[model samples]
Target: MSSLSGRTAVAGIGATEFSKKSGRSELRLAAEAVHAALDDAGLSPADVDGMVTYTQDANQEIAVAREVGIGDLSFFSRVHYGGGAACGTVLHAAMAVATGVAGTVVCYRAFNERSGRRFGQPDARLGGEPSSQGLEMSWHVPYGLMTPAAWVAMFARRYMHAYGATSEDFGRVAVAMRRHAATNPAAWFHGRPITLEEHQASRWIVEPLHLLDCCQESDGAVALVVTSAERARDLRRSPAVIRAAAQGSGAGQMMMTSYYRDDMTGLPEMGVVGRRLWEQAGLGPSDVQAAILYDHFTPFVLTQLEELGFCGRGEARDYVAGGGIEIDGRLPVNPHGGQLGEAYIHGMNGIAEAVRQIRGTSVNQVRDVRNVLVTAGTGVPTSGLVLSAG
Candidate 1:
């Protein structure tokens, strides 16, 4: 295991209500979540010495700290690549705490994506800017590959062709996520589980991708408190020990438009992250009692399972068939409903779910959850974490 492994722990997690419209400012949402996390950890904002968040988040670290009444910060950082930065924020926080650079760090993400700037909508400005990111999108925007669904659809189609998988295979993932969500009162889709047939009949967002296959555009915020493992053991909640945390960017990476890769059938970047996570934790797939794999899109979930070696390549279809990913199955997944059933706080909520499972407080808690695997976004430079009971 790496020197950083088990040195830090997630002692607290907090979130605003998941909703389609959270009528508050993004900054307010951030403050609320951060304050809630500190409260959950039995710490005050004055105790926070560091902060981390996504680059895409509108709330600045200093601004959030000021609003939350936090004092001088010794460390502050932001990660890029949209949802891919979810676990990366925690990774940054863990490193800071492990190295004694900071005593307590609050990692947060807050956005009114649904009520404010919806990421699902295509904007021509993406290709009009002179920045490096605009240059990357220029090649695809002109070809009508605009929205996130469009970008993922191209890869999903290729994956289907390579593996002879059907759309129903993807729908099964949606069904399972919704089923789990139905039981979670905090989920937006609570009490709304759907059948595979319902998924097939859902309107199409893009060819080879149903509306149900895509995650919800949610308005919410989530935050986590990271402190040294020793200190965490003294906190209010059971520490979710940071077993491993890693980020990876594969060759030929081009954001979501990574079609140039020779094989579009898998997420090699996630594979890189997976290998590092297991190595750092000195654990394998069998050690993971549950998984909160990112569900921005259903197709990517299958690729992530394969990338992490839970199954052979192109075998996720059969692996997820029946109730394999349910709470009673071999590997329960997204028991908190995931982005599909829960709100999409850019994979932050998924990490919260992992923590809940480790603490044995999850609504869909699995039995003997010694280790829980949580992954960030796919089809991009992604990150992952292996959280264990402390």
Candidate 2:
């Protein structure tokens, strides 16, 4: 087992309300989330000695500390990539805690994705930069392949041709996620369940991807507090032990689109992370009671299942059919409605849902959820986690 396994646990999770417009600055949102997470952990700002966030986040770590009343921090770090860095943030925190670099660590991400800098629209920011990622993206942006949906659609089309998967199959995933979100009052889609027909009727953003298939352009912030397993267990509230956490970049990896790979049908990066997570946790697919697979796009949800060993290489099309991913299905996924139905605060909110499943506090709680799998963004260098009961 990895030394990080069972060494650190998530003692608290907090988030600003998932919304279309928060009307607050991203820094304020981060401060609110950080303070709330500390409160949930029964910890004060003075106790935090480390902080982690996405490099894309507008708020600086020291600024967040000043706003949230956090004192001097001995460790601070940032992960690169867009939503792909979700679980990687926790991985960094676990490493810090396990190595005695920090006693208490907070991982947070805050953004006004809808109200400010909508990622769905084609923006010149990436190609305008001097970095290699920008140079790589410059080639595709000129060919009308700029938005994330367009980038993912190239792979989705190939996946269909290779695996015989249909748009209906993808719609089933959308329906299930919205169904779960309908029941979750905290969800943006609360009481707004959609039928598979509704999914089909939604306008197409790109061929093989309906407007409904894409995750929301939400505005929100989420934060989690990580501490030693010993301290977490002693806290008043139950903790979600970090059974395993991993980050991986697959062969021929690129920032958002890696379509040039010989075989672009699968998420090999997720496969790399999945193998490490299971080996670290000493568990496999069958051992997991539920999952919070990233649902940035409905098709990638199917691809993740295949890469993560939930099914055969080309068998996810069959595996996800027949209510296979619902609450009572073989592997209940995204019990909190995921990024599709819930607000997309990157993937941090999904990690929080996994913690809730472990604590038996989720409104869509799974039965005997001793272990829950949570994955970050796909189609890029990504991360995953195996969370177990305290």
Candidate 3:
């Protein structure tokens, strides 16, 4: 077993209301979310000596620290890539707490993705900086591979062609996520579930990706508090132990559009993440009670299941069919509606849902949630975590 397993735990989680527009600055949103998380953990800002956040996050670590009244920070770090860095923030924080690098750590992501600068639009900010990412974008952006949807569409199309997967099969994922969202009070899609037929009829953004299959362009923030296992016992909420945390970047990995791989049908980076997670946690697919697979797009969720070994390769379409991901089904995924249904606070919302499951406080509660699996974005260098009830 990994030494870090059960050494650290998540004592708190907090978020603002999910919305299309926050009407506030990104820095303000970050500060508000940080304070709320500290409240949930029964921790004062002075208790936080460590901070972690996404590299794409608009609010810097020092900026958030000062705004939240944190006096001195011993550990501060940032993980890169867009939504892929969501779970990684927690992983970094957990490691800091586990290894005695810091006492209490907070991982956060905040942005005005919708009302401010949008990631979906073609970025004019790439001024050819002398960086690896700038180099990768240079080859594709000029060729009109400008947006995330278009980058993922290339693989989605190839997966469909190779496995005979249909757009309707992809729609089933959208239907299930929306169904779960309908009952979640905090979900933006509360009481607004869509049917399978509606998914089929939705307008096409790309050739096999319907508009309904895509996640929302939400603007918000989320935060999580990680501390030692001993300290979590005295916290406000039931602690979700960090059973395992891992980040992986595969061979020949590029940005969202890594078409040069030996097989374009798979995400090797996520497979790399899955291997370390199961090995470190000493658990398999059967031990997991639920999951919060990243759902930036519906098709990627299916791929994540296969990559993470929840199901065999090319079998996710069938695995997810027949109510497989519903509350009463085999492995309930995204019980809090996920990015497709919940507000897209990046993948941090998914991590919060996993914590709720272990705490036995989720709206769509599952029985015997001893272990919960959570993953970040699929396309690029990715990350995963196994959260469990201590």
What would the per-residue lDDT of candidate 3 be over residues 5-34, giving only the tens digit for each residue? 888999999888888889999999999889
Which regions of candidate 2 fall more than 4 Å away from where they truly are?
Answer: none
Model 3: lDDT to the true structure = 0.90
Worst 10 residues of 3 by lDDT: 124-133
Question: Candidate 2 on 221-309: residue-level lDDT in tens?
Answer: 99999999999998856989999999999888997789888998999999999999999999999999999999999999999999999
lDDT of model 1 at position 155: 92
TM-score of each model, in listed order: 0.99, 0.99, 0.98
Alpha carbon deviation, residue 208, candidate 1 (Å) = 0.4
**C-alpha-based local distance difference test score of model 1:** 0.95
For each candidate in the order shown, give its overall lDDT on alpha carbons: 0.95, 0.93, 0.90
User: What's the residue-level lDDT of 343 in candidate 2?
Assistant: 88
Alpha carbon RMSD to native, model 1: 0.9
A best-first ranking of the candidates according to their lDDT comes to 1, 2, 3
